[model samples]
Target: MFGSLGLPELLILLAIVVLIFGVNKLPKLGKGLGEGIRNFKSSVRTEEKTASDENGQDATKDANNT
Candidate 1:
């Protein structure tokens, strides 16, 4: 999606963000956004792991029953 945005467009976007949020709050906003993304990524990974584990256990149970 961002493949079409050139440097100038990115700079303009950054300028708009800075104008809207101001420089002082940018760091806090960035930190919160980062933490949110991190948490989301970790949760997704954990969910995928649990799903795979469950599938593996079901397969094993089926094999043993047979």
Candidate 2:
């Protein structure tokens, strides 16, 4: 997935993150990342539901016409 990052570049990025957050905080950071992903998924599902509801209403109107 990280096709653009060579070994040195990846190491540099990791070093920066480690410096900023430290080793002890990585787990907490991971948990927060997971929560963020879950929230995003839920938001996407809600948007899909709203769009489907609108489409269903339109379909019902079309059926009524026929």
lDDT of each: 1.00, 0.97
| Model 1 score (lDDT) | 1.00
The Cα RMSD of model 1 versus the native structure comes to: 0.6
lDDT of 1 by residue, 3-31 (tens): 99999999999999999999999999999
- List per-candidate RMSD values in Å: 0.6, 2.1
Model 2, stretches more than 4 Å misplaced?
1-3
> What is the TM-score of each predicted model, taking all chains together?
0.96, 0.77
Instruction: Please report the TM-score between candidate 2 and the true structure.
Output: 0.77
> Which tens-of-lDDT digit does each residue in 1-66 have in candidate 2?
789889999999989999999999989998999999999999999999999999999999999999
